[model samples]
Target: LSVVQDQIDDLKISLNISLRIVLIGKTGSGKSSSGNAVLGWSEFKSDLSQTSVTKLCQKAQGRVEGRRVEVVDTPGLFDSTMSHHEVNEEMLKCISLLAPGPHVFLLVLQIGRFTPEEKETLNLIMKAFGKDAQKFTIILFTHGDKLEDYGLSLEEFIQKKCDDSCKKLISDCGNRCHVFNNKEKDTERKYIQVRGLIKKIDDVVRANGGGCYTNEMLQEMKRKMEEMEEKFKQEMQKMQQRMEEQRDENEKVLQERDNELKELKTNIKRERTLREEEQKNCNLFFHNITIIGPYFQKCAKMNQSFAQK
Candidate 1:
């Protein structure tokens, strides 16, 4: 019995699942940089630019400490270049990429550059994902070197230096946070930070009972897409049917007009023929009257002379 139980436990251990992580943040928050750091190499482009570097949802995967990890980098939530509809579409696209869904969402933030959009990020996430999004979120602060330059620990900065909104954000995320210094060239230190981040991720997964965060919003979007496609097909069919019906009706009308025109032409020709014949008859009668007029007069004179005698 002991041997059998040991074998079962070994089988269960081999079933350790992979991690699917999605990054969310405002533009210029070093989301791409953090993703590269997590994967211990560069899989996404990172740079200093006023414009958003990522315009679409992109996914990259690698092995971290012998565990499979997938990172999905998304466009900034409040990028000015993108409209509201466009941003929502990209987010939905991100959700679709991580179908059935992400085990954790790393809410990327800069060390000391929290803006108004950053403050409203949680609200947006709730609006997009749901209220339960907070449960599966982990706050990830990039540019750790800045915090080091300030000579402040992560906890100290949160308690003393960070603004009220930032503090509230951290609190809301259950104080589950990690910092990454992408500029750190020391492989050991980078490895340590990545390992720590992964540990927190494992904790989040455990807390959620080994289940990923699934959103009804994703399912709803899919349903809407299907409905719209079906509606478009139906509309196209109706338009084609209407066009075909109109074409047949036009042909019928044209045929009737053509028949009516032919009948009118025949009637006009008959009337012309009758008029010509009547004119001819009148001309003949006048000619006959003119020829007999002289003859009649001579006959009348002879009859008068005979009576006198």
Candidate 2:
């Protein structure tokens, strides 16, 4: 019994050390661009030349502000030229890169083009990715400019345009939604979004294993499953007790994140207003300068006439 217990302890430690992240989206939705954005290096080819060139899995590795950020750009599904089986094969091939499971699925989508075809394709994403996938999905929307132009916050636009099916699909993974505008060119925004993704991944791990996992769990060993589940309950109780005691601290952390997001939105709004005011002042200055130049020239001509008289 002692030896058996020792092995169980060892298995749990191994499971906690591994991290994997996979990227999925339709072609031209900016998966490759976002991948480069996350990795902070243009490791993958991002071309908009209307070609189906991504034949297989491409992986990029980097340190995202201290976290090991690994990204795999998978060949997109539902290509007009490819058959369903081909798409499935390519998707599975991508999954093979991150073997057992990925902590998060970054499902990229376009700004204003969530069409019926895309809707059907979105359903296929769930099927190919896996069932019970909501527990590990994040809806990443691209095109920040449009949302800002519409005077809609990311939260508001998601509430309005990101429909129930989209909600159910991603919320299964963890209610993680990110809107990325390719044109915005802000590195900090990308970092912030990636940080939130990592946070959701932590939540998924905690919820699933109760802070205990192992290769045996990965292998789906039934005997180990029972033992782990039982052990998980005791550990969960301790965590719950700690959480209950420190509920206020946890709330404070969440409140801080809310405040940060509000400040980001506020800053964007302030910048837009400043640009409009600057343009207004620039036009006014140029107009007055033009009129004053002509007036001075006329005054000089009148002085000449008076002197000649």
Candidate 3:
């Protein structure tokens, strides 16, 4: 009886285990709705917008089938409005939000609406997250209602209507895929889909030897970010230092100019003093000449009158 009880306890613990999942895809790929569906609640904002709705990476937690699940919703990759840098920052943020690492990456795609952008979805994901992320990825197709409306199973749609690239994407993901009807009204049906998804997630964790995607890549990316940040800091510091040095050099040049100007003013003042003294001496000599010339003229007149007598 004790052994049976121990086995039951172990099963309960397994059922109650936690899961970390991230949803990634292009804009308008139903990532937000899919995240809400997985949580079995409307934790994420779902809407129809011409632009990407979830602009940042956000995390929410809930219990699905008695298991704790963490869902990280991210903005649309390759969004026209968002720059590549913005997307990378968000990707890093997603990595951090998942903390240690995510157990699965749900590459969400919309059924019957494959476009050119959607074709590069997987490649973009691998580029942003890393190549190894593919091993932990699961292709999640939303808008299952569309498939239901056309009376086609998910697999049937893939084989009949999906293009070669789409098929290749599925094959690359190891044929692991699931469809979600986010608008379903029946609780039991929603539960079944979510349960099936959880089962797939369990399989992935098991295949990985019960390990989540390692933090090695995340650490490497972070180290790169830190390096970039450090480099930027160094560049800014060098620029600032150069500016300060230039300012000091300019100040020194200005000081030299000021000193030269002061010396020029002093020389001008000395020259002016000398000119005044010379002018005074010339005026006095001219006055003495004027006085002596009159005296000599008077003596010459007296001598001439005496000789005539």
Instruction: Supply the global lDDT for candidate 3.
Output: 0.84
Off by over 4 Å in 2: 1-18, 163-174, 210-309
lDDT of 1 by residue, 15-39 (tens): 6566789999887888998999888
RMSD for all candidates, in order, please.
11.1, 31.1, 10.0
Each prediction's TM-score against the native?
0.66, 0.57, 0.66
lDDT per residue, candidate 2, 147-196, as tens digits? 98878988787678778766565555466677767665677876776676
lDDT of residue 175 for candidate 3: 94
Those runs of model 1 whose alpha carbons end farther than 4 Å from true positions after fitting are 1-14, 215-309
When 2 and 3 are scored with TM-score, the better candidate is 3
Q: Per-residue CA lDDT of candidate 3, range 188-273, in tens?
A: 99889999998898777766656677679766756776898899999999999999999999999999999999999999999999
Positional deviation of 35 in candidate 1, in angstroms? 0.6
Give the total clashing residue pairs for model 3: 0
